[model samples]
Every structure is written in C-alpha cells, then in structure tokens.
Target: MGHGWRTLRRKILTPNVSATYLETRGFRRKDRESQELLEKVGALFLAGYAHAVEASSIADVEARLGTIEHRFRGFAYEGAGMGYGMLDGLPFGHRHHNDDFLAGPAADQIYIVYCGIGWAMARLPRFRWPKAESLDPLLRWLVLDGYGFHQAYFHTRRYVHEHYQAPRFPWPDDESRAYANRAIDQGIGRALWFVGCTDVAEVARLVRTYPAARHGDLWAGVGLASTYACGASRDELVRLTELAGEHRPQLAQGSAFAAEARVKAGLWIPETDSATKILCGQDAETAARISVEMRPEHVRNGALPSYELWRQRIAEELMSLGGVSK
Candidate 1:
C-alpha cells in the first residue's frame, strides 16, 4: 500500500517536473540549470556512502566522510529540516564520531556535522533494518536535536523511548510527549489533513500543548506533510501554514521553502530543501535562486543529482548574503 500510494502520488501530485505543475502548488518557479554539476557531487557522495557503509569499522566510515566533509560543511540543514540530507555522506557508526574530520575541534557548535551524520543515521535506517545501525538512537536524537527536534523524532526502535535523565521541558497544559510524539510519527505524511479530517481543535490544541522547543518540530512535520504530500490547494496551504506558524513559523515555512527549491531545480523529490525551507524561509529562496548559476555546463558535468548541487550553490549564495550563518 505504501509503495502503491507513493507511485500514485507522483502521478497525481507531481504529474510533471516543470514550473507549470509547481504553480498549482503555489510554487512559482523562478529558474533552471544544467543537470551536470548536480550529478558530479552526487556521484562523489554516493561513492563515499557506498564505501562507508560497507566498512565493518565506524572509524572507516568517518575516515571516508573526512575526505568529503568540506563540501557540505556550510550547507544548511538545520531547524525544521534538520538532518533531512547528508545520508549519502554519513553512514551509521558504532561509536560516537572521531572529531578529526572537522576543520576545528568538535564542540556542541559542531553539531551541524553531527546533525548531518545523525540525519543519515535516522532516516536511512528504514531502508534496511539493523543493516547500517551504528549510532545509538538516543545519541542520534541528541545530536539531531542538539538544537531541539527530539520532541518529534524521539522514539524506540520498536516504539518510542523515554529519557528520564535528560533535561526536561514543561509540557503544554496537560499534554505529554508520549501522545504528541506518537501522533507526529503516525502523522508523518498526513498530519495536516488529519487535523482537519479528524479534529482541528484537538490537533491544534495538542500542538499548543507541548513546550515551544519540542512542539515546533511536531508542527513543522505537520506543515511539511500537510503542504507537500497532501497536494494542498493554495487556500488550504495558506490556512495550514497559518495554523502551523501560530505555533512554529519555522516549521510552517518548510513546505514552501522546499517546494521553491525543488521547483527551481526541476526536482520532484527534494533533499534537505524539503524542511530547510521551513526554517530558513526567504533565505532559502535567495539561496535557491543563486544555485542556478552554480550548475556546471552540461557538457562538463555528469552523473550527479541536481538537488545535492544546490547545497553548494546555496553555500555560495549564503556567503554573499553577509549576515546570516546556517
């Protein structure tokens, strides 16, 4: 059913990979570029990931990642889109990372790199259970949520896990993490519709029930699933965004932000842009616009995914922005 629905979604929602199709979703495409540069970087990462995963040692994976860390060091994958990308460069490992790959010594600030690794660690596991398992789930949550997404991403391998020892945040009125976390996970691709289909007030009330730090992630997930997966109408998108923004503007902005980048790149399946746009908002738009020029000439580039190339493009764009740091 999941596989079949995925197919139907592409046909119905993505029907085409052009600006016209995107316009239906309120994504006004402002650009295009050669697929060349995107492929080269993708190839490099794929090679890196393939080798990293094959190794028996976590040390080997980090060693392989060390060679390519510089490429994405500045790529923005934080906030609502935290850990959505970088799965290709960071395979799971048994022990915590060996900080040598980073430009400087590791600190909590260096969580960006760990966040990238953690994202790959979390999202990629659904592909083959226990196959690439390395990083501890709690630790992965720690690094990914080092900024505060654990509210939504926390879970046990078979069910949700509890953290009795971690610092605690007050829950909203009477809401509990158990109720919210399970709902968000179950709502993965359908929460937005579920709120209306089920009970808007209950869902909205639930969103407001959690502490701000964690609830933002739940709201962000709702915003993303509601906006992108449901093929929401412009009015619906606006309403959903408004609802999510009320609790978490960063999460509400995700779908549009991702949609804008994917539309510009002509990608039906986006990468970090899916959620990064939620947190970065207009900053994502500006970076995506600049990414077009980053595309190499078709004749010169080969075998890479255009979406990955956009990160390099945005990295360059952000450098020019002068005030913001991802």
Candidate 2:
C-alpha cells in the first residue's frame, strides 16, 4: 500500500492513547508513580503499533522499534507484533505479515510476539483469526494469554469482576480445547497485576474471589506479570510471595517464565532482576535456566500441551527449592 493509505490505516486502527489510562479504564490507581509507569507502557505499545502499520517493510519497523529504550523495547516489539497480526487478519491486506515479522525482527521476542497476536485476536472477527495449527504447538497458548490480558484489561467488568470465562473457545481445533479457559485464566491473572495497580493485597483479594481450583493458574499469572512487568516493590513482592502461600511454586514458575522472556529478548532490566530475586528465589539467569531446562520436548505427548507441562515442570523445580519466602 502507499504511504498515505498506510498512515490512514494506522490512524483508523490505533486506539486513542487515553484508552490506556487507569482512570479512563476505571482500573485502580494505586499512586501517581505506578499509574505513570503503566501508562508509559501503554504509550510505548501504541507507538510500536503505529510504526508497524505505517512501515513499508520489516526493516522499517525494526528501525523504529530499535529506538525504544532498552527496558521497554520488548513491549514495543510486542505491539509491533500485534500490528502485524492485525494486518494479517484484515481481509484485504497481506496474509504473511505476522509470519514474516516473526521470522525476522521478532525471533528473540517470540513469546511476546505470540501474545501480541492474541491482542489482535481480541480485535478481529473470529473468522479472521489465524489457524492455531499455524503457530508453534508449544507456544500458541501464549496467544490466548494475550487474549486474556486484553479481555481483562479492557472488559474488566465481565472478565474480572463478573469472573466471566469464554465458554468453549472455538479457535485452534484440538483436544487442548478443553484447557483453553485455563490458559486464558493465566492471562487474566497477568491482567490482575495491572488492574490492581500492582497492589499485592488487592491483587490477592481479586484472585481469592475466584474459585479455589483456579488459584494455581491465577497465581502463576501474577508471578509472571509481577516479574516481567516489574511494578511491585521488594516488600510488595515479598508480600506477594506470602499471599501466594501454597501456590508459591506456581508463582515462582511464572516468575521464571518472565525471566526467560526478558533475558531471551536481551531486555533484562533492574526491576526484572529484583522481582525474580524476590519471587523466584533465584537470580534472573538461574530462573530463566530453570524455565528452559523444564521445557517439554514434545508438544502433544500428553493430555496437556507441552506448554502446560513446561509450566508444571518449572513449578516442580521451584517447589524443590522450598518455595519463595519473605
């Protein structure tokens, strides 16, 4: 498409910047610093999205995203991934944008990219959704994670407050369909971090409101968000570990996954370092190693997908460490 048309497309597709404000979303505003930090994250994401939609090539998008600060660069790539995914889902646009981007600039940020595709899924019609089989078998679940985050972030009343779950998600036709809600819940758990403004007590209360059976996955989500997003303080992270209680193993697993994601993308920051140390009882590299070592080789070997098995193994590994403690 021409530059003019692409600019117009970007303008039409991107949400207003204010949509991300906690106040605008009716989400909790714990304090000025926390709200500003989270809002900046949203701004970076939108900026990345705009770059992707308007760029002429993958190189063009990369050039723009490269300018983002090291700490927030991964999120920019994530937003770019969403832009590409959204374009691919459009009826008249190129169909291979997401694949090409993933093959090129997004190779290291694969986890964040897949989750970004889930963000696209939230915006597109069901028919326009990508085939689940097209994604890596072990990582496709991250797309649902992205979707869950989007739902809980934007539709808080339904997905968070009302405890709404997608009844029979239709994408990715497979036996794993039954486990879809759990994956999405993991995303919801992640969203709770933002929803509660990284308030450990509030986030814990929100999780507690859900049924007991769902707490494990939910706590895992919190761990991932807390570690990856880096909003909670050391004391708050300690409280999070304390609040996690029996689900500490799952929480640690999530922290490890977050460590893996940030380290793999070369986007490790001080906040991630602190969060991992507090939540996973290990340094970032060690936590990341645990995640890698525990990853399952076969995607379809068991009743659960390799993704869940990977998470389970990581949780088991952390549990052996006697779980994270204040």
> lDDT of each model, Cα atoms only?
0.34, 0.89
Q: Model 1 over residues 6-54: C-alpha lDDT tens digits?
A: 3443243221223212223221222222122222322443344343234
RMSD of 1: 16.4
TM-score of each: 0.31, 0.97
- What are the candidates' C-alpha RMSDs? 16.4, 1.3
Best by lDDT: 2
- Please, what are the lDDT tens digits per residue for candidate 2 over residues 1-326? 79999899999998889999999999889999889888888889888888998999999999999999898888888898899889999889568898999899899999999988999999999999989889988899999999999999999999999999867888678778878888899999999999999889999999999988889999999999898887888899988888998898888988999999999999999899899888888889989998998887767823477788889888888778764642
Q: Candidate 1, residue 236: CA error in Å? A: 3.2
